[model samples]
Target: MVVNVSNLSPRLRQLGLVAVLFGAIPAGLALMGGGYPFQVGITALIFVTLAVSLNLVTGTAGLLSLGHAGFFGVGAYAAALAATKLHWPFLLTLPLAGIVAAALGVIVALPTMRLISIYFAVATLGVGEMIHVSLLNWVSFTRGPMGIRSIPPIEILGLDLSGVIGGYYVAATVAALAIFAVHRLTHSYYGNALRSLREDDQCSAAMGLNPVRLKIEAFAVSCAIAGMAGAVYAHTASFISPDSFRFEESILILAMIVVGGLGSLPGAVIGAVLLIVLPEVLRGIGDFRMIAVGVFMFLSILFLPKGLLGEASAIGLARRQLGAAWRGDIGAGWK
Candidate 1:
């Protein structure tokens, strides 16, 4: 009972922190009472997935994507269609949705890879609008604004996990996986290549980094992850429409990364959780809740330009963790 937590190895400390955070979710929800609080927790976790995925492209790779929500919608629709029309299981639909969204991302990246700066951003906006409009007007396929209803809940190995607590666990698991994957990717040499592109694509290309190919790969991966998040959203929400993935949604995702710290993974997670939970916490403010949220964001930007957990600090923390592992101080965990 008198153990010194600070003296624990980095790897063990990391694992303990993760376990505590994951365990705390249900406990916190229980204390607050399930119902709406559980819903908020589920939504927060889903956005955590989205925020991490978006960070791969916008934060690490230095691509300003304004149409990320379109890919998210694509995944949601893909999962919805497969579940409803083809009677696919949750297991099947999840990966299928990611694959579908990745394919679309690759298609978009192929033509738009040559563009840079605001041009690329504008192109993505157009792509997002196109996806939204198609979903809205395609009537026959997307149900034309009526939206898809009665989608199956999450089930795996014949076990239904659609209820509130089960749903929260599922979402938390996905969010945790996303964070782990992105954390590994960002703290490695591959992630360094992505950062190079972000800092100076032309310089990176001159150094034989193949900037175009890297950009496409990053975009595709990011899209795939976003799609997976969408799949979870569709299954858990049990309904979805084009309205769920609009340009406004893209802005929110972007804002998460920005407010969290453009190049920081921890920042992305913190920002997502903050943005999602802050609004709910302010609900007691009634009419001015949104204004209060806006004010908080403004104050954060004004005071913390680099974010609450900026990229530099995150990278340092990661390096220390990796160093501890590599030195055999942590017994080879998280290397």
Candidate 2:
């Protein structure tokens, strides 16, 4: 009981911190009781998962993807179709959804390898829109606008997580795992390579890094995470439509990472929570809620250009500079 937490390995400390933070969300929700608040909490957790997954590509690897919603939708429909048509267990369909979406990510990455900057972003946008349209027209498979219905509640280990609090717990758990995985990724050697690829793909290639292969892997991993999030969303809501996964939705997700800090893991979670909560808190504003949200986002970018968490980092950097100066280490740079 008197353990020295500060002495723990960095990895263990990170795991402990993340577990406590995520665990608190559900615990707080449970204490607050259910209803609209409960639903909002669940929604926040879902987006936290999505934003974290998106960070794998956009944040770590610097791949701009306007088509993440497509991957999300793909995973949703994959699991939905599997559950509906094949009568597969919900647990089994989760990975199937990820695999299907990841395969699509790979296919998209193949063509994207040749493109860069806005072209690559545009390509991803096209890919997302294509997926959205295909879902709209593929009535035999997706049922088009009618969407997939009657998706059963998630059942795991003989316990059904169909209820409000149950679903929240499940989503929170998934979000926690996603955060931990992404944290590890951003701190790992592979993650370092991804950051290198993001900064200079050509230079990284010259240094023996395969830019194409790394980019593909990042896309595939990012999409797989998105797919899993979508599958969880589908089951939690018990239904889904093509409308939920759209270009605008993709933009919203992209905004989450930008406002959160492009390469910051905590930034993703913070951005998701703020964006998700702000909308609901402004629901009383009726039609003007989005306008308020847009204004808020505009201000965030204007003042905190590096992002909220990024701004904090900038402050920390300044403090570090001051500290070095105080320690008489500042003059070495000019030498």
Q: How accurate is candidate 1 locally (lDDT)?
A: 0.90
Task: List where candidate 1 sits over 4 angstroms from the true fold.
Answer: 1-6, 325-335
The local distance difference test score of model 2 is 0.83
**Worst-scoring 10-residue span by lDDT in model 1:** 326-335
TM-score to native of every candidate shown? 0.95, 0.88
Off by over 4 Å in 2: 1-23, 311-335
lDDT of 1 by residue, 56-96 (tens): 99999999999999999999999999999999998999899
Looking at model 2, the pairs that clash are none
lDDT, each prediction: 0.90, 0.83
lDDT (Cα, 0-100) at 231 in candidate 1: 93
**Which residue pairs collide, candidate 1?**
none
